[model samples]
Target: MTASQDIISLSNPVLLEKVDKLRDLNIGQHVPLPQLVVVGDQSSGKSSLLESLTGIPFPQDQSLCTRYATQITSRRHNKDSVDVRIIPGPRALEEHRKHVEGFHRQVPSNLEFRKQFVDILKTANERMGIRADVSSGSGTVFSEDVLKIEICGPHEDYLTIIDVPGIFRTTTQGTTKNDIVMVKNLVKRYIKDRRTIILAVLPSNVDIATQEILELAEEFDKSGERTLGVLTKPDLVLEPSAQAAVCDLVQGKKRPLNLGYYLVRNRGPNSGLEGHSELDKIFRKHPWADLPRDRVGIVALKEQLKSLLVAITQREFPALLREIVSQIAECRREFNSLGSPRQDEREQRSFLCQIAGAFQERARAALTADYGADSVFDQDELRLITHVVNITDVFNADFHENAHSLNFEKLGRSEPSEEVEMLSDYDGVRKASSIISDLRTLIKKANVGVLWSKEFVELSEIVTLGNTPMPMPRDNFSEWINGIYLKSRGLDLGTFNANFIATAFAEQSRKWSEITKIYMRRIIVTIHRFIAAALRSVCSEEQVRTQVWEAILQHLVKCYKKAMDQVDVLVEVEHRKKPYTLNRQFAEARSKARGYRATEQLYPKARKDTKQFGETQYVVNLDDVAKVAEGKNNMEQLQEDIHDILHAYYSLAANRFIDNVFQLAVDYCLLHGPSSPLKVFTQDWVINLKAEQLERMVGETKATKKRRSGLAKKIADLENALKILVS
Candidate 1:
């Protein structure tokens, strides 16, 4: 058996399933077998070639014998017969009669009826058995009809050949009447299921038009289907040498016709024959005649038909079957990959809602306990209370100008708007609302929060309190403090503090400097934790771990860069500041600045510079702490450690998940294997053949034990091979 046959046998079950589905769905009407379409200029020997390849007789008279696309298939009757089925394009049958009359009348060619011209010529061939003389009128007299011919051979295998309308005609028309469109549609239909192979017949007389035909052939071959070129009318050229030269020039070794070309003859006894003596004569006359002859094949018209029957029955049809089965499998995989969109969306939403609920619960608890309900007459009231208490007296005094402006602004605006201004005093509350709104929207859209919630909180806190202290009215200290107390809001301060403390602890653990990092990390961690928890709680523990680790790594990269930037800025400031001078008043100011600079430089250095005592006091430390700090002051081990910790944690927590993903990737690759066409064909052939054998061997009688035994062995061997392939 051939490689393709082998694959078909192994994948017989799937192939059968696909065929059943096609039959059940009645999809065969839409997807036909792979068609080998032949097209060329009028009198270009297209029909003659089709007859030669399909072993079917095509009328050779000057009259257009085939009007529309005729599909030919091998049929089994008491005697072998070729069933010729005609599939006319829209309005093709009606127009065919008119086209024939028009061609005979020798009427002037109308541009509007250009397509109809080819159909008329085809109809004349089909019914009247007349050929239009090219010298009589323009090519537009021909009609637009895709001629289909199915040649049923004595054997089970037969190829469907589509003889397209000729391009060249005496008509004034500049284009091949509907030929391109028909060819394109043929390609689309064939490619849907079968691997379409184009057999382009190029006349030995080379021209710009022939070159264009070769170009189109190349474009059509990109569907991963094979395209074979045939140099026709070898007898027309007198010199064999000249003929070969023309063939090489027309069919170059480069793109489109890279598969090489076959020399053919379409007149006399050798007419419709490929690789015949006439063809060899042309090749021998060419410079590249030294090329292998096996790459080229030849036969007379009658012999060509016989050869085509063998080719289709033995090779092409089986290969086409393999291609169809493979395409079906591919379609199945694509559908599987897409999954159920609604289910996916619903799952995502559920996850987001869960995280959002958690966030809302935490935030509400913190607010109610920290700021009393009585204090929070509205959303802004809670902010106003927090702003009054968190701001430092000194900073509040500095903002006295804005504070007084607030009273006037408050009177001008609504109570809610005024409270919003006061809450703005504490940058945290001012920014929180915007940040929360954004978080809510993202959560709703993605059905998940940012994985790093701790980071965001840290960022908010730093931005709010980095340069200012809590601001409150000192004149009414008790009342001011009590107004913002938990008791007023019917909330417990301990509960609020507990939630705040947990967030604060997480921030310290992460050792993040920038409030942005804090804010970002908080959202990221929250998302990560939620996903991890949900996966663990609802799905597999391994999946939870895998997703959490992936999320953590993605967020870590973001946080690491932010931390590095902050460190760079700090380092730059320390490097640019000058040392202190205590002598003058300006010197005193410079002295404090220098001291602050020294502290900044020393702190980083001490943190980064590690010490080891070998000989104790007797040995001077080779690495100077101060110098090391100055050189590498930007080092942030704490940040790096946090990343390492997260990585290690996830690795330990989700190792199974990682392993599963890895295994999945490996399995996918094994199933697909190398994507080279030759390899795919071989693999598919093996699979198909095995499947076919199995199906045949499934049921056996005692009388057939001998045959069944051999088949059973073959099936065992195939199963073993399949196991090895999958493994």
Candidate 2:
């Protein structure tokens, strides 16, 4: 080794050792692993070139023998020896998200020579469980695994170069289309590192344009800035002019790369330890006389590579550290996000507590529209959570003003009294006509009057039905009623039995009561239906991407599901809640429609008062109104009393129903249950999350622990390297 080379090597011991420590920890696979990489098309004599560089013989067979990426770290030493080690790929790291898997196994002892190198690979693949799972029996002939060979010799450069499996245009024996893709990807992973300088080898026999390695090198080092084009098998170009062209390419006759091409003649892989020196002899001196000695041999190539590696590494180390630190921040975020795997009941409980607590707080904030004024949620999310009150208001307006609905009582014909006239009680029948006359007079004076329509032949069939409550008149009833005066014929007034009139009214009254109750029950159902929907919107997944949601649900589904299932218990309570109060206007409207409760005896006080609500006056002459009930006792006014009491009661019931639904069913049962908001999961759900529900991954997986160890070691090594470089 030259004194200058030794000085360069010794000067940066920390940088080299730090890289070694990273390799030792197998941290490269997780990030862009930095190193010099060799890439070339199939059988481009890359093996021969490697042999010449390190003097290790490669098999000359046409078979794809160099299957994995082999890294050769050659340094000058007093005693010559080789040590091989296996470095695992990213597959073994659980945090590694890619689907690809790779192999890692080592040669147990010092490699004696080149023959054992190939043997070690074959043995490693079999030992590491590499074989074809497909029925074709093609076997696992190639892989992305790496084999590290550390060689020391007196003439070797203090350098590390990775030789990836050669890229092939077509598949040969026992290889599939997958083999081609795998090889390209394997080669790409190495050369894509910004720190690595690409060495693209091409055979002199093949036109340089035909080689794909040049394109691949350009993929990473686009301006040919870090790529050094190396030509191998220069002797294979038989024509003198062809040889001259090759020499011309080496001398920059064709468009020269920023890092120009070099030439080497690899006679054979089995060329002995003195192989590179033998190539340097140049037996046919005149054939190659035009070429520069520095651009034509392994000795010059090795020195050139050593100088390049030293200069580039020293120059690029700071940028490389910055990249590592940036990547470390990213990985640490991922590493922290994965958290820990929950392997035991205690760990699972703790893990669930952290997630559930976070979710519950967010959910509470979402439901109450209490996301702080500074909080920034999406428009859709804000609308959903904050504007639930809009739904409540709409629901309120719908049920309140619709008095003609089935939920309210009003006058309408159910069955004709002509049918009741068929009964043989003639005296009872004659009075029924007077009974109709009597009620008709009373309805006209009442403010809420829905009189029988013109279609009715008789007034007996008048029924007050659901939701169609009578409309209250705009004008005061007292003014119209006082205009009426009755003419007295002075005929003999007869006593009459009025039981039939009361019986008919009593029956219709019962029907109205039943219908109104049924309608209130339906209101309960409507309220809860919307509440259920609100529950789903509150508990559902949001836009954190597929992976975050999957991970959250994968761990929290049981807790969420358990809470949802128990929601019905709260809803049932809301459904059964009955209302007890009435709005003043609602009660007055109902009372005016059935005002027979203000009996004839109270007539003197009902004069000319524009009083409000239930106290409003409706005057009628006592003499004429009394005559409508001529000679009748128990059955005469009984139906009127029932109507007045029941209609008022229905208003109270309807108002009570509305309040209960919004306050209890929606607000309490869904948004704010007895203990907490509907968005909260029950304690039982978190406490009993199935042991199997979680992946036992509270940073708990073996792979994650291994990765953590690797990362910590990597950070430490990098910090050490930075310290030394700055120092």
Candidate 3:
């Protein structure tokens, strides 16, 4: 059998199955056809172009002649029958709500007035009228509304010609704001499908070099649909030179896309035969004239009525149907893939549980190490360290909060009051002094000589107040305290107290500075060794060794500087000549040291504290870590849960993919073959009923030629069969 016959035969079983499946699916039945959506600026000849192409005298002069998106379909009827039915535009309820509200506001006193006014507005908007109004007590008030028209003609068996509202007008006086929104909604709804082709009309007067057309083209191009540009009102150009100039302006400019443009004219009374002929000659000479002429035919308003009938009823529509079917199938595949929903929650749940368990174990180990075996600390040294950690945590949290909140504060605002600063200073002094006293006791217990006599106490007070360095210890008591403090602080110790310690120590330890240096160096080396060992244990030795060494070196340098600051602060306090200068420096130092010690101690501990973190890494085979009870209830439950989740996801994806394939196949068959249910439904009911009703009621008939042609073919086939039987 031939390709056509093969297609028809294949469609029989397929079409039947599709019909049954569609009923089972309960999807809306749609008659597929190639859609040519005409769009342009208001009064930019969108309606005129439709009239020209279809030969239908659509109310071109009506102020928004195409208000709603009208869809036109071509159908074949019996001999001596030609039908034209205007399918009503889809009711845009959301758009109409604004109009209804506007009417209510305009006529607040009369409920009936608002109702009547809105009704007229809706009618006028849909029919593409200039203005719609209802008479009130005062006078007739006009409201803006636009009309949208869809002209169905007999050009092709399944081709649809849609006339859209004009865009890029200087004024939308006749079109309501909602009308514009409606047009955009229509474009989004139709163009997103990729099955529809957009025929954008541009006025010849607009500068092609402008950003307007470029942006418009970009919007359509990005949608992944085929968009064609038609330059309308060529007849108005009058001069051949002007037309050529316009063409060159469009063609020469560098655009986002290599958009094709066509010159078109809508036949009008002003556009006589001579004018049309001249316009035609000018269009033919243009660089883009080689496009198929039949697809780009031009006709006058009166002639449009006849041409449209022929165009809508012709075999060209069947070819369009094939193209639309193919496009929709492609779109279906893409949409199905992207729109697939999340599947098999049970499987996801099981995996989530496994991840949770791993994190829980890690969390417990961390909490125990950081908080210690007992929840409380009785040792003076441990209590001091814990207090420092608490203070550091508070400072870190507040600093982060202030950093973020400072941006929101009003500009040119005064700083916080001195009372607040004094209170903050008091709190800092109390915490630091308490921690220092505890440290003194711990040092004595550890066999470090008592370094806190009356003189040392006075020096400690001065250092605390002014961040000054104290005199070098006679014994190595200072070295012992520094070591204990640095050890407790961990990695963060380097960041928090580097500056304070550096300046204080440099001045205070001038006499035995070299000995102080030796003690500080030992502490730095010890911290680095600990950090490196910890890093090696957790991460790969090969990958992290270099990074660990670099980090340690940086921390040591930072801590050395802070230790020196402590010495400097103490020396400055001792050498000051005037009490005023000493007091000022002391106040400044106290304020500066508010969060330093706490910050230093907390920084290192924070790095090691991972109790709060859950599931930093995932590892396979739980059996490797612990024995698995194969037949245990808990293990069985976990295994079953994981299995269910995996199966669920797989099943969902498989079902969805299969359903998408089947649906696409059904749509393809319906759009292509003659015996498809969609075709039969459209031909038997939608087309036939509308045509018969229009003839019986409206007493209007446009063209009967297509119906006559179908009859002639049928009769010829029957006669040939009879002759063959006789022979």
lDDT by residue (tens digit), candidate 2, 1-727:
6422332355653456456555545556644445678889878888888877766666665443577777788766776677666665645444321222233334332345555766755555554335533224544666555667777766556787888888987766567798899989988888887778888998988888888988888887778888888888766678878877777788888747887888877666555555566776662476676677788788778888877777776665556556666766776676566544455767656765665565555556666676563243343333234344433443344334332122222332212442211211123434455554553343234312232342122111222224554443223212211221112112323322233223322322233233323232232222222233333333332221222234433223233223333433333332333322356755665456544323433344446556667464457666656554555444333333434433454445445545664555445544566533333343455666466554332325566556666666566655554444344
Candidate 2 stretches greater than 4 Å from native: 1-10, 23-28, 59-64, 76-81, 92-139, 152-156, 168-181, 209-212, 215-222, 235-238, 266-278, 335-340, 343-369, 373-400, 404-680, 688-727
Residue-level lDDT of model 1, residues 308-328, one tens digit each, is 434433344454454445544
lDDT of each: 0.38, 0.54, 0.37
Alpha-carbon RMSD to native, per candidate: 25.3, 14.5, 32.1
Instruction: State the lDDT of candidate 3 residue by residue for 1-727, as single tens digits.
Output: 5433333344222322222222112111132222456666666667666655544445544432455544433322232222222222233233453443333112222223323433443454433322343211321122222122222223323234555444432324444455556565555544443334556676666655542433554575674235656667665675656666655544533232233445576665455444345556645644436434532335332233333333332323334334434544554554333222212333323322332343223223332334353333232222322332333333322222221101111112122562213212124535565564554454335322222353233223222222234332343323433453445444541233334333333333233333323222322222223233333333332422343234234333444344445444433443332112223434444334433322332333332223445533223344432433233454333333222222232223223322332233222222122322212212122223333332332221222233333334333433332232122
After TM-score superposition, the amount by which residue 533's alpha carbon in candidate 2 deviates from its true location, in angstroms, is 9.6
Q: In model 2, where is the ten-residue run with the lowest total lDDT?
A: 480-489
Candidate 2, residue 52: Cα displacement in angstroms equals 2.3
* Index of the highest-lDDT prediction: 2
